[model samples]
Target: MPTLKQKPKQRPFCFSVKGHVKILRLVLTVTSMTFFIIAQAPEPYIVITGFEVTIIFFFIVLYTVRLDRLVNCVFWPLLDVINSMVAAVFMILISMLALIPETTTYIVIGGVFGLAASVFCIADGALIYRKLLFNPSGPYQKTAVHDRF
Candidate 1:
């Protein structure tokens, strides 16, 4: 048993240093957009968004290297891909609507951003947790779903 006074060992976050950089990039991308940035539809913004998206895709495609045959096959990458997609969707919507004259558009952008961002953040945390906390060998194991059963 671990002592209450002892600190838990720091777990490696699921991301490589490159992965950490991508995570940081996403954080910056989400926070960097302002009403003004969204209003202009600046070329730089589009470029940055595109770059972040590409990074997200690369992470999903490459995520399997760290994870083995157990739970990593589908679930981990699936969760991450969904998380990135949801974030991108809101960011896109918010950017498109921020310049519109309608107040409802502003409300919609804010509301969706709030909701989607929450889920994205949770998924991000879970990815890190899974990288650090999950075990491949255990008393409870991953069982394949049989099509016939």
Candidate 2:
């Protein structure tokens, strides 16, 4: 019989069938626990679900990006998707309100506000994505590359 000091061995980073499942379960349990804790927070702001931090982060990022170079890259295209979604939402709500004559003024107000926000969102997302993904082409290139985007 094997001595009490002897134990079965396992390869590093190579989980057995049972071990792999256990790791997955552990990861999922931790993730769900974190999500529930965040969900329980009071006075949640930023109407967009699950992206509140993203909005604040982008706002800060846009304050720093150089707008000229960004237009040449992929930021503008992806922003189009975001803007279209915003516009479509505004249009649907406005159309529904148009059926009620009293809401015509509110519809106009909402449309204008929506249009402005859509533009801001596009510009902000593009600028932030570019800033986080690229570095200034100067002495800081190598060092910045090592840091987070």
Tell me the alpha-carbon RMSD of every candidate.
14.0, 18.8
Model 2, position 51, has a per-residue lDDT of 41
Where model 1 places Cα greater than 4 Å from the true spot, the runs are 1-40, 64-118, 134-149
Q: What local lDDT score does residue 19 receive in model 1, on the 0 to 100 scale?
A: 59
lDDT of 2 by residue, 3-64 (tens): 67767674432243322422332333233223323444212211221242243334224423
In model 1, which residue pairs have backbone atoms overlapping below 3 Å?
none
lDDT of 2 at 47: 29
TM-scores for every candidate against the unseen true structure = 0.31, 0.28
In model 2, which range of ten residues has the least summed lDDT? Answer: 41-50
The most accurate candidate by TM-score is 1
Question: What lDDT would candidate 1 get against the real structure?
Answer: 0.49
How far out, in Å, is residue 80 in model 1?
A: 9.4
Of the candidates shown, which would achieve the greatest lDDT relative to the real structure? 1
Model 1 scores worst on lDDT over the 10 consecutive residues at: 106-115
Please state the error at residue 122 of candidate 1 in Å.
4.2
